[model samples]
Target: MPATRPPTPLRTPRRRPKKSRSRRPRPPRPPPPPPSESPAVDPENCPVATDAEGGVDNAILLPDDPWTLNASSLTLKDASYKGIVEVRTASGATKRVLKYVISGGTDIGDLHQTVQDKRSGATHHVQAAKGSLSTITDGDTVMYTESISGNLLGLIPITFDPEHPPPLDIPLIYFTKVTVKQAGQFGGTLHVPGLRQYITT
Candidate 1:
C-alpha cells in the first residue's frame, strides 16, 4: 500500500500598501469692489418749490439734490432719501399745509391733495378733466404723479373706489392711488422737491 501524499497548502499573495498623495495649497482670493456712492447734493437745491403765483413755470427735480424724506416705502440706495408731496395754502388770515409720503416704487400714480377754505375751514377736492401727471422721485425711483395747476390748466388727483371700482384695463390708466390730507388753498405753494417732470404715459 502506497502512503497518501499530503496536499501542499496554497500561498495567499500579500498586497502592497498605497502611497499617501500630497495636495498643493491654493492662493487666497481677492475681495470684491466697494459700492458706488451717490453724488453730493446741495442743500440750497433741496425742497424745490412750484409756485402758481410765481413766474417760475416748473421746478426740476434731481437725484443729486438733497431733500429730507420723513417716510419712505421702497428700499433706498446710493445714500438717497425717500420722496414726499406737500401742498400749502393761505386763504384770508388762515393757512394750511398737507404732506404725503411717496411709496410703492417708481410707478406713476395719482396723488390727490384735498383743498380747503381757510376762512371757513371747509375742504374741497378739485375735479378736472385735463391735468399734467408729473413724475416724482427722490433718488429712489419715478414712483408717483402729482397734479399741479398750470398757467391755463388745473391738475388735480382723480379719485376711485378701491372696493367696488371700474376696470383699470386702459393702457394709460394708473392703478396706484394716494389721497393727501386736507390742505387750504389761497394762492399757496406746492413743494415737491422730487417732482421731475410730466410722465408721458
Candidate 2:
C-alpha cells in the first residue's frame, strides 16, 4: 500500500476571538438661539382710532406685565372709561349695567371721575385733592380714587388653577386716548401687557 501512511493525525480547529463593540463618542451639540424681543409699547406703533360709540380711542402695550395697573402709563385728558358694573338693587337682586362711563378730568395726576345717569339724565362727578389712580382691578374696579393706599391694582387673580378655571366674572374697562407717559420715573420701565384700550361696539 502506497503507504496509507500512518492514520491521518487528528487536527484541532483554531477558534477565532470575538470582537468587542466599543461605541464612539458623539460630537457636542451647539447652543440654542436667544429669545426674540417684543415690540416696544409706543403710541407711534399703535395708532389712534375711533370706536362705534363715536369716541376716540388709542392704546399701547406692556410686553411684561399683564395685570398690575401701571399708574404712570396712562395719560388721560378729556378721556372717559366705560365698563360693566355689578350692583345690588334695593330688591336684593344683582344687576349688571353697561355704559358706566367714568370721565372728565383736566389734570394728569388728579383724581376726577364723572358718571352720568341714563334714565334721570343727571351727572355726578368726584375729585380728590391728593390722590392718584392706584390700580385697575380685574373686576374693573378703579381703586385709589378715594383711598391712596392699597395693594398694586391687581388686574386679575394672581394665583389660580389653570386646570380648573376660577369662578371670576372679570370685567373689562375700555379706555379712550391712553397714551404712554414719558419714560422716566415708573414710566416705560413698568411694563403691563394688559390692554390699554379696547373698542367695544
Off by over 4 Å in 1: 1-79, 82-108, 127-133, 136-175, 181-201
- TM match of model 1 to true structure: 0.19
> How many backbone collisions does model 2 have?
1
lDDT by residue (tens digit), candidate 2, 70-180:
232233233233333333333334333222222332223333334445556654544333335423222222211211112213232222222222243223322222221
Candidate 1 per-residue C-alpha lDDT over 125-156 given as tens digits, one digit per residue, 9 for 90 to 100? 42212233433343323222232111111133
TM-score between candidate 2 and the true structure: 0.19
Deviation of model 2 at 121, angstroms: 0.7
lDDT of each: 0.31, 0.31
How many angstroms is residue 106 displaced in model 2 relative to the true structure, after the best TM-score fit? 21
Clashing pairs in 1: 106-142, 106-143
